[model samples]
Target: MIIMWKNDITKEIEKKRLKIRKDEDLFETVEEVFDTRTLMALYRIINKGIISEMRGVVKSGKESRVYWAKDKNDNDIAVKIYLTSSMEFRKSIFQYIQGDPRFKVVKDYRKMIYTWAQKEYKNLQIAYEVNVSVPKPIYVYENILVMEFIGENGVPAPLLKDLSVINIELFNQIIDAIKKLYNKAKIIHADLSEYNIMVRNNKIYIIDFGQAVTIEHPMSYEFLLRDIKNIVRFFRKNGIDVPDDEVIIKWIKEV
Candidate 1:
């Protein structure tokens, strides 16, 4: 004979969690509609102490959901959890990972997103190596990526596009930072735009490196030029008269 205590009935309580399903704001609505398996994956991560507490769901992107979590030391960490769905990612991922040596083995859509997250982890590693102020990647398991939370207390830094840094000082620093990124990293952040860069303490911190690509890749120059174009466009939008081609050339030959 065996008896189960109140705490022993935790699984039964968690069974009610089946009601959880796809977040409408997320890129994909749940395919299975309240899949116990996906929930189990989330449970496994939580149980492993990777994140001691997960707060409110933050912004949802085209492929992942951003969550604010607290670690063992009570420090905040940003968790980018990729949705299990893949229809959207299948279309655009090829451009970023086409020449990635680590991704040659990945063939399926689901595998591709996981590979994308892995790529992001590697990109962060490269950036940090060169002293770029992106988030410090902690752990990336499957679709989940845990990184240093870019915030203090409860406020995250506002993105560059959201704030104004008036003066040549801020602009020049941004240009210099891009120079380091291009020269040292030998990679271009393909999707970089004003919205993905953060301005904190009058310095720039680039984020969202998922689309960063190698310099030798066929699309590398295309991506590099596009990045320079976007940066120039942003600054020009803010009333700065600058030449996109000149900025690209300056970074290439003058840096």
Candidate 2:
């Protein structure tokens, strides 16, 4: 009976896989990463009417893959799926998870990945609610997260690192976002850099919040300082005049 149930699930996923394979961009990724469990989680999200269709891969990384998808209204959305089999991901996320007060660390590796996805969704929710420039989180289940897509069609916005022109206004906007995130949300974006910031039509959106932590974390200050340094370094390198890291940190922490 158990074997029959498992086969049924596999057959269902295979049917969906055939449909997804029609998109050449998503075909390789679906085959590469969509294990039975991950596919099941995604299937559940689709069944819930949150995701109407899965399109192409927008971003691929060691820990997760972001796909360009559409909602029931045909609006573009991003689907981030964390790789459950990534042992290295477990080690890298431990520091942030250990210090975060919101979550309890789990020994089960798959469970930890789910926690990480949930953490990112919660962090995005907190930041968005505080009016910080971030992807508006829609839903999260197991290792999958659904959010507003920051780009048009299937193409993602240019990263800050890819931009040719940098101006003080852009720099100030990011700093203000950081300040809002720190003061209003009371969370630190532990990993902030040019690579994770998206620029589109003069607007900026910060992405990837899996490692963010609350201000109550033991290493929160250090993480905050690091985030500040990263932004300052990137702006300064682009010939934009920015304040010292210490000055920015002081301002962000101020009420």
Candidate 3:
């Protein structure tokens, strides 16, 4: 009976994959790297009606690629797929996983990558709940995470690093966002910097929460200080006089 149930489930997943293939073309640029399991995950997401048409790649990174997609309702969404085959990615992600209490230490590399994707989703949810400006998470299964698209008409918003003008008001807004993310959400964006912030209509939206850790993480304070320092350095270079990193960190941690 158990073997029969397993076969039934396998047939359902294959049916979904066939339906997805008939509906749209996906993973054009990423075709070489996407294994059968990854393709199945995408099919599952489509079967759930989270995404309808999977479009072109918006951004590609060493460990993941962000795809522009449309949901069943025709709303734009960003689909992030973590590459399961990168050995370096596996090694690099260990530090963030080591001290976190939420996840148990999984030995399998693929499972670890899935956990990393889930971590980002959970972190985004925490920030969203506290009114922090982040991409609204829609769904996550295995290595694929679907979220609100940060741009319009298939173009992404400009990264803070790419912007030529850096206004003082905008600088303060980012600082306030950092404070809220810390004090309210209790998550430190360990990898925060100009590169991870998107500027849309003069508003700041934080992205890339895969490395963020809760306040209880062992390296949380250090990570927080590093985040503050990175932002402060960028603003100072742009001629926006900001408070010292230590002062900013103190303010963030203060009730």
Candidate 4:
């Protein structure tokens, strides 16, 4: 009876090991892309029960890559990882963090990247709290930020720039979203454009808040005007009779 019990236990252990191996195999390609430090950071996050599995890349950009992942409860999560080796990114993000009262100046590049990730998370949180249409922020660890994925399965919603159908109401909704971000969230999406606006389920969502600045920033109004201009330009090109950026800006500034 003891010998039979030992054989059954060994078989169960082997089955569990096989299951782990199969799960790890799914991310083999993803594992090859991360560096040692990033891998360790991801390991720490996973061990903390934040992430159950990382699937594949959902969006790829010059400075970062967003991956489709799942939490312990199998809920969809977007994991955005800032590339530490991108020297251009390191230099470009300096302007966004320079005058922000929230963070101190950091000389280390890796620390700066971490700070950038944290900044985006905080920006999303602020926007979300104010009913702005943005991905709900979950957590930020090192250079990785986890947020609510804004699409179904592993597929992300199409950018406003990619949508074939454009309507006047949608344009108006985008304008209202920007105004709300400014008045309620008190932040300017300095880099706002059609490229970062996601269209899913007939709703517009603003994204890529890494460069958003507080209203106190010296360039806040300038950034706000630029955001308005970008949205107006896009809508005009799509044949929407949009008002001028100045008019929109003046209306948004009304208290």
Candidate 5:
């Protein structure tokens, strides 16, 4: 896990933008590409032995920014650093995070994100332990998470929604895998849509577990059903045969 760094990319980035204020949360205060604290965290990771350099920014979502980084062994890594400077961003994830047992005591937004980041790291570890196809987690600190890069070279794998290959067999495998994730792992990939599952080298790698909650948690059944709905819907759109309820039933009863 990357902890800290000596370089200051934030200052360099600041130099590029002359009109912006130099506040600590400058990244969040403005409509800039990234938050100041988050960029510093990336620099810290690089200055330390955790990562060599920041390759480039990949996706900047509402809560976090994902970047490609190189590790000491010259292997590519994906770093998801959350922005704690924005309460608005924090508000977005609260609904999915509020009921989790781990974050029952979290009160502040930053603290909530810290807990969420930790939860994702733990979820990834659990999936790996259960032999679930997922990115191997490397390190997590503050609201930052580092993991093995999912795509080959410097490019990221496209979401399953954009690509289709083979037949219902592989699609069935995805269904079976989701069932195993529920039955064996006792967790739901809450955001289990075509956008979250990646198909690479004809194998499926499930990404983004930040919203995954236990089956016993409140609204778990709803989330699981939605996942089944999305899985079935996407595959069906690709010309596969099977009803959503049939896939749901198979997942619940026999997978």
Candidate 6:
């Protein structure tokens, strides 16, 4: 019975695989990312009607790639797929997972990558629930995460680091986001920085929460301080008058 069940599941996955292959352009783009397992995971997501069509790559890095996609309703969404074969990514994220109480350290590389994707999804959900300015998480399956797109058409919002003109208001808004993320959501964005922050229409949206840890983590305070320092350093470099990192950390911890 178990063997029969396994075969049935395989047949279903193969059916989805064929459906995905019908879109040659999307199949070609997906081929650039990884192997059959990743494709199968994406197929499962498509089978659920969460994604209608996969579009062009918006961002690519050693760890993951973000692709613009459309949902069944024809609305844009972001699909983030973590690279299962990136040893560098595995090494870099190990520290974040080590001290995080919510996730246990896994020995299998592929499973670790999946956990990393789930971590980001959960973190985004927690932040979004608290009204923190973050992308709304839609679904997570294996190494793939689907979320609300933060831009129009196929163009993404400019990162804070890429912007030429940043004002004090932006800095203050970011600080407020950090405080809310800390005090309300109880999640510390361990990898917070200008590069992961998106600015659109004078509003700031924090991105990339895979490395964020809850306040109960052993190194949460250390990570929190580092996040404060990164924001302060960036705003100060842009000629915005900002309080010292220490002072800002104190203020965030209050309440």
Q: Alpha carbon lDDT of residue 128, candidate 1? A: 80
Estimate TM-scores for all models: 0.80, 0.89, 0.90, 0.92, 0.80, 0.91
For 1-255, candidate 6 gives per-residue lDDT tens digits of 345588889998998988756767668877666778998889889889999889989999899999999999999999999998897997898888888888999988888889999999999999999999999999999999999999899899999999989899998888899999999999998888999999988889999999999999999888899888899889889888888888888888898
lDDT of each: 0.72, 0.89, 0.90, 0.88, 0.76, 0.91
Which rank order by lDDT, best down to worst?
6, 3, 2, 4, 5, 1
Off by over 4 Å in 5: 1-33, 85-88, 164-166, 253-255
Ten contiguous residues with the weakest lDDT in model 3: 22-31
Q: Which parts of model 3 have CA positions greater than 4 angstroms off? A: 1-24, 27-30
- Best-fitting candidate, scored by TM-score: 4
* TM-score winner, 2 or 4: 4
Better of 1 and 6 by lDDT: 6
User: Candidate 1, residues 1-255: lDDT per residue as tens digits?
Assistant: 777788867866666553243222221422233245455665567678887666755667667777777888899888887776756877778867877655674677767777888889888888888887788888887777888888665467788888855555656666666666678876778887887887777767788888888777788777777777887788888887766666555656454
| Per-residue C-alpha lDDT of model 4 across residues 20-129, encoded as one tens digit per residue | 89557644835566677887788788889998888889977789989999999999999998888887898799998997888887999999999999999999999999
Q: How high is the lDDT of residue 130 in model 5?
A: 81
Q: Candidate 3's residue-wise lDDT over 106-152, tens digit each?
A: 99889999999999999999999999899999999999999999999
Tens digit of per-residue lDDT, candidate 2, span 130-242? 99989899999999999999989889999999998889888888899989988999998989999889998989999999999999999988889989899988888888888
- Model 1 deviation from native, Cα RMSD in Å: 4.9
Give the winner by lDDT: 3 or 6.
Answer: 6
Off by over 4 Å in 2: 1-29
Q: Residue 189 CA error for candidate 5 (Å)?
A: 1.0
Candidate 3 local accuracy as lDDT?
0.90
Clashing pairs in 3: none
